[model samples]
Target: MSTESHNAENTGSNDSVVETSNLAGSGDFLIVCEHASNYIPPAYKNLGLDETVLKSHVAWDPGALAVAQALSKALDAPLVEQKLSRLIYDCNRPPEAENAMPAQSEIFTIPGNCNLSQADRDVRTKTVYFPFREALATCLDHLQARGKSPVVITVHSFTPVYKGVKRDVEIGFLHDQDDIFAKELIKTFAAETDKFVLRLNEPYGPADGVTHTLTEHALPRNLRNVMLEIRNDLISDQESQQDMATILAQAILQAEKTLGKHKNHTAPTTKPIKTGN
Candidate 1:
């Protein structure tokens, strides 16, 4: 079920948490945008930060949702996204992680998230984290019922500079220990496009704990998966987002074809692996 409309409604200052589009698409690919929106649901009062911070990359991946939506259209794939800001509760992180409700992200401190009581943490987990997980699980279950195994592609964006240091990679394909799917994508992108710098785990890696969603949801099931991180500056607008999506969509399609040819020869690991950025 696509919760595009109802999932955008947050009653009584509560967050909607999860939003999905193209939920019934038949393609054997699933697109996920964990930091899609920067919405703070009014209850947190912008997490006690200014409007600029709310719009910054610290709150959300600036253009990840647009790229994911474009990919959903391009590939006829289902897209599931978190509707609230990561400051509320990072959907990509496990609840036990310290940054799950980060007191500080990058250099800015999240005043609202500081010194949280156990009850406050639990509420955020129950309201935001659990719902997001359930939504993705439900979607995956539906696809499995149809005998369709999906290649999960997570879309994310990173700032061009981190703590005043510039990052050289324009695009990053992040993966955990199971790098088969990510490696295939990297090879395809390297061969097909030279417009931007591409690398494997550049700005962030599994050590950054950014691959929690993939590790928790896809790895155990042995689902082919990859996390694509575009430099935020590269996809700051509609045109750029569309361009990146087209480039990524082509690469993913080509990689899927390659995976198909080697399906019988290789299989993805089913064991839960250590997570990453």
Candidate 2:
């Protein structure tokens, strides 16, 4: 079942935290992992779910965070991650989106997030969503100010089979309207192996009008961006996660080549800017 909204209450959780390397310099890429962790702060007591459930996809991307960490180390890039469960408040989703405050996520029921009032939602937006996004925008601005055009790569992982259906593709690129980055990445995967079939906008899409951070923030800067989805089964272990991270790192390197080919073409910018909390 899809969770459409979440109710909130007073909690002793810090809305945002920035995890980074001490090596501070402009890196060519800036990575963003919207559902980085499944951590429900000590105060929330796992948000009324089984502690084992905390480790499940309902609370976090099963293997995506590991892939992101491997990619960050391999690429020497700064990664901006959401510290809490997406169930608490999805960093990728717009504040007003239905799933922005999910009543439930995956198989878990969010006891703290059922039948929320508008005021509760507003507090969540202020305390959780805004702060992380604001940090992202500020980081982007700082990098740009330093003359670094960071290529935004969002890493996420999906369950291998949902509702008992098997998936064939190992990786997918999620995007909307602008296919510049997605198309190039597809070509890279195609050339790499027949076993590797990259799906364009498969698994997820931005067409339904749910706001995602990449489309909202990075796209406006004319910054090259793409959302990557890896099947959870492929990266369920450390070895596999590293392997995919290497694959993605190479693909992004190839995408840089393709972007150079289309220097004359660029997506037009849009204007509804919101301050990240």
Candidate 3:
């Protein structure tokens, strides 16, 4: 289904499920923020939760959109973002995954997601998940048609403390089976920044199912890709978000230069399934 038709059907006075910015940008980087907003449509009734929970990090990545927007502007790249709350349906996850409509996130329970019927799950997938994926796919297709091999960069945020433990790592570069690009970018960040702890998959890793978007969109196409997880506390304000985005943008540019030198890098042979659902 087309994005306009899906938005008309599902979003009642709310923003579109998927929003694209700088679509005509000529840069070689394509930014994606799967949990950009925490807005739930009036139809869901806040997913049967209190108003306070809807605004918390559990509902969405607190500063991911700000960093993504900054990076899009800095790099002159197109950005595809999800506008609905993850509580409705996490755009980053496969539609059939249990966490797609999470019954609980972090320590809070999602009352609306519990005991959902199959029909309800299907509706969520059809309305929110598919449209978001289709929009991103369309963006990639557009760039590819223009002879652009855009690097996919998915931005995310992590809580300072999870499950009662404090996380010392400030930034995490996550990857799936393909780690060449991510490793290069990590080396660049390590050499350039000494202000915060940088690590490979500290807070979340491939096992956490966080790489679904990268694997689905970038892996099959052999696009240089990585998922960046910044500490929410570090980017709690506009100034910090801009600062972090600058650092990340520089690292990405450096990595691109380095990768450009290696002309024979081969992509994986396993093809992704046609449907991310």
TM-score of 3: 0.93
Q: How would you encode candidate 3's per-residue C-alpha lDDT over 1-277 as one tens digit per residue? A: 1123237256674557888888888789999999999988888889889878898889999999999999999999999989899999999999779999999898999999999999999998988988889989999998889888888999999999987889898999887777788889999987788899988876788777888998889887888888999999999999999999999989899998988932245565653322110
Error of 3 at 114 (Å): 0.6
- Whole-model lDDT, candidate 3? 0.86
Ranking by lDDT: 3, 1, 2
**Angstrom error at residue 244, model 3:** 0.4
**Against the unseen true structure, what C-alpha lDDT does each candidate score?**
0.85, 0.71, 0.86
Top candidate by lDDT: 3
**How close to the true structure is residue 134 of candidate 2, measured as C-alpha lDDT?**
75
Any idea what lDDT model 2 has?
Answer: 0.71
lDDT tens string, model 1, 1-277?
Answer: 3555224323253447787778889788989999999988775778799999999999999999999999999999999999889999898998889899999999999999999998888888888888889889888888878888888899999999898988898999998867899999999988888788988876777878888888888876678889999999999899999998998889999999988832233335555354433
TM-score of candidate 2 against the unseen true structure: 0.85
lDDT of 2 by residue, 156-237 (tens): 9887776567777668886654667777887876666666656877666666343387777777787777788888988988
The TM-score values for the models, in the order shown, are: 0.92, 0.85, 0.93
Residue pairs that clash (backbone atoms under 3 angstroms), model 3? none
Model 1 vs. true fold: TM? 0.92
